[model samples]
Target: MTLCPSPQFAIPDTPCLVLDDGAPSLGESLHCARDWAAQLPRAKYLVLLCERRSHFILGFLAAQMNGMTVLLPPSRAPGAIREILDAYPDSACLVDDGPPPAAAVVRNCRDFHPIRSARQPASGEVSVPPEHVAAIVFTSGSTGRPRPNPKTWASLVHGARLAIRRFGFDSRHCIIATVPPQHMYGLETSVMLPLHSGARVHGGLPFYPEDIRLALERCPGRRVLVTTPIHLRACVSANLDWPAVERIISATAPLDKTLAAHAEDHFKAPVMEIYGCTEAGSLASRHTTQEDDWLLYDDFQMTVHGEHCRVTAAHLAEEVELADVIQLKTARRFELLGRHADHINLAGKRASLADLTARLTAIPGVVDGAFLEPASVNGATTRMAALVVAPGISEARILERLREQIDPVFLPRPLVKVASLPRNATGKLPRTELLELYERQVMRR
Candidate 1:
């Protein structure tokens, strides 16, 4: 009925993993949980992360077994991390080398030893209720900020089980993750999905195009690739024979149809996109090789009201208002028009409006700036554009700052130089109206 960390399908003598590289066995993973629970008996909540995917899986599962709340912010930005820590009150943080600005730290999964060579604590068991707070996930709010939505242990188990059935994964599946485990998509697919479905996990978040090809080459087996749509296009364009992959899953933002088609044809693997967020974890995934219409979650119900998407009596939340804009046909089927808020979808990656604006505002050379996603030919969504201070900064230099902070897709395509952006009575730019400004300033130009 629940996740037991049962590595029933792991290949015998098969190389499993930790933060360093390939370094743990199934029993070793469980043992890590026992040691962690023992070390921090008094801590009720923990936020743990290892730069390695394997350690993340270990810490998260260990926390579940130990009955602690885990906080997951979509981005690793200091602002987001600080907010999560503040919300949790007093909580121990689990970390590897890359840590948040916060104080509490745990053993780096790579270097951490078992605290004992010959003793294993008796397996600790905790009862989990569907209403209990299992993990907290943060979403960039429409009002240019972050908000947390909590999910239960039951939700994760149900979501993982449903995805495995839809994707045809089993113990035979070996996954290489290009996305960080912080996001709901990566956490579910790379960590919980692998553990529950009996799949093996690999390390590192591949950023460059070449690293993806190299990662694929290193791991050999029935491989599944977990990545965002932005990474998918880059890897496909890298002009390398991608490793033998069985399935590819894309999330974060919406996928370009052309890129999806190209990926399947080039990699000779089925390309699928997940319709999900930090709030719901993963709701649906449509096989790009087949159709764009997302196949609804078998375990959850989706309801579209007005321009907002809401769920009733879910494994995760009730009366949950999602950040996604959906068109509902029935209880289980729907189409995504766009997100419900300020977060923009660019080539299947998200750039927080606040993060973008904050960076532009921080650059001393700038006065004021705002980013926009313009509407395009036959209304096929176009690239992002920005309105920046006309005085001190050159357009080329301004874009460089944005590129360092956000993804390439989110960078202003033509770069508009203007006095300032328009705002409503309360100083908000509606999504529909934001595109109008892009049209007048950038697209028409």
Candidate 2:
């Protein structure tokens, strides 16, 4: 399979990125990438630590053009950075702004200004070979230690094309994403979608509801909100009037129907939920308000073998096993049961932690919550515990609502009320952090 269907340099004058200051044309981006690539040392691997979306895109393209593999770590924590560098001993860090992280050779994007090359830039398309490794995206480390997943240029391009077609995006659409560019979902939807398709991406990564609305206001064309369940829920719960958005795309975590419906009603747009993981870029998406099952991407096939399943596509290097437990409705559609790791069996009764968490968040006045099975000591099944953030509602009332939704045997014991749940940037509650919170807040008490 040939990797390059379209050339990055072909669309020179087209508007590619919309920033607060001004829009950068595709020509300018290519020139900037070329300038940056010229200064980079002859390293086989480069670690991208760019916080801004546009800069991240610039570095990504430059690395690709320079024939260097880009390493995208799950986070910029000192430990995470160290792990990535340790894994790729010949790697160097590329930064758009801020002080360079310790323990790696640093290349600042700002230092390399965009300049017109002596030779005229190629007006024609360039093709990246199918086997070339474009990037290495690290897992979220929610289950355990973050692991690296290498993606070929062909796979990235194929996935981007799938998203563009699935969402019906074109040059007329402008994307505003809340997730960071390093995350897989963010990389595909916010960065790759614009480059592969003709869509324009907003440069800023908006988090607060007001900021999100303001970003949308600044955009000139039809708008799309690329965000996660957490950010979408906050936007709806805030009740702030939203700007006109053509549609919304959600990923990073499972979006419940209630939240999806609320977002659709509040924004007056369809809420599309994407199902994927770090291992398989984005495989399927659904309009949550209309469909209960996910529609897989074209040319992708899945095989269910008991509790686990594997996915294969023309873009994928091999059949990749999924951590999710799914009910295969057809060859191209499936209902996500939950993560295999999230299922808990106690006293011969089965329940999914994801389902319980969704139920907890659905209760009125409950802002955010999570249900975790306390670590077992002495090989005994420990009862479930909960950490909830409901300032106005009493713990008794919260439990009453939970009792109505869940089995008494599965009701969380010692439900701890708190100010907020410890959610990461993408709105994921890491199990390690959850365990830490339980040990300090609940077990200590």
Candidate 3:
């Protein structure tokens, strides 16, 4: 499908982004994009390191208009940024704050002054080729090294349209996302949704519970919170009065049912979970509190072969093989068992590392935690271990609570206590970091 310049619901005066300074009209955004594109350095790719949503939106649109593919690093870590630049030597970095990263060329987005003209730019429709590479988003590297996945204009736009319909929200909704724009879920929901579906997004990347509430309160009408399970739990525990919210969309990591229930009750809004990865945008969604089966979005089909599953959609460049072990419930619905790599077999008792981690976090007083089965050494798997964040609770007490929930065979051999898990921006625990922490805390001692 050819790209549409703007959504039908958006007019020239419609707010594309809601910022603390002021909302930028759709027409104004177009004007800014044009101006920004003209000043950007000539490059095949532009690494978007913009923290502010407004800057990210402008930079992304400018790159698209200039035929320069946007490159979204897996994280804002220095190493992650350097790896992308090294891999794509023809790319330039567009940063919003501080010194621009080391690259062939660097463009500070803050330097681009917005047009002070009261006159709006002509919002003309521009068609983008279906096969045009729009972006390359990297995986979170939770399981291994981060890998780049290319997204075409057609695919990104199509995925956004599918989400718009699936969520049953329109331009009237204001999106306040806690996840950063670099992540796939953040890009698809916060960036792509507003640009393609006419919804207005909050410019700030609110993290703390109070900040999120303030951002939501600033919206004029219906509000949608696009966040992860970590943010949701924090909000639910904050016990602060929340503004009216139309819906809460969560992704990244698996959301616990109890947390979802608490969030729904606290915010008085339904909590929805999206199942997808970097390779594919959002594939399916389900109301976490009310449903166990995930309904696939339009035009997407899922097929199961043995223990593995593959997904195909009209907008996808090719079929994507999923890492999750999904149990097909119906033609267009499925249940997530766990990640294929998370399955464990010890003493003939099978368990999922994800499940174990979830159980660990569920224990009273436990703040954050993870279950890791370190890589085998000399053909022998290391005993399963755990890192927990329980302030007052001892490791033995945490283990006692865990034993009550899980089989004895699956209990952590040496439960290590810590302040927090090494979670990335998207609330994903990278295995490499977890292993390092484990070695430092348990093995060295």
Show model 3 residue runs off by greater than 4 Å: 1-9, 101-104, 115-117, 375-380
Q: What is each predicted model's overall lDDT from 0 to 1?
A: 0.66, 0.83, 0.86
Q: What is the TM-score of candidate 2?
A: 0.93
Write down the worst ten-residue block by lDDT for model 1: 423-432
lDDT, residue 296, candidate 2: 94
Candidate 2 local lDDT, 314-349, one digit each (tens): 888888899999899988999998998888888778
Worst 10 residues of 3 by lDDT: 1-10
Task: Specify the highest-lDDT model's number.
Answer: 3
Arranged by TM-score with the best first, the candidates are 3, 2, 1
> Per-residue lDDT tens digits of candidate 1, residues 1-445?
3454344423323344423344355555667765666655356677655555655766776677677888776455465567776777667777766544565544455455542334344332334565556788665442455567777887877778778777877766678887777667777888767666666777666667787777777665688888876577668767787778888888776666777889988888888888876666787878765774676877777776588777654465556677766787666677776554555656667665556666665566876567665555564446766777658779988887777877777777778887665532113344444555667765467
Candidate 3 residue-wise lDDT, 188-213, digit = tens: 99988777767899988899999999
- TM-score of each candidate structure, all chains considered together: 0.71, 0.93, 0.96
Poorly placed runs, candidate 2 (over 4 Å): 1-4, 7-10, 114-127, 377-380
lDDT of candidate 2 vs native?
A: 0.83
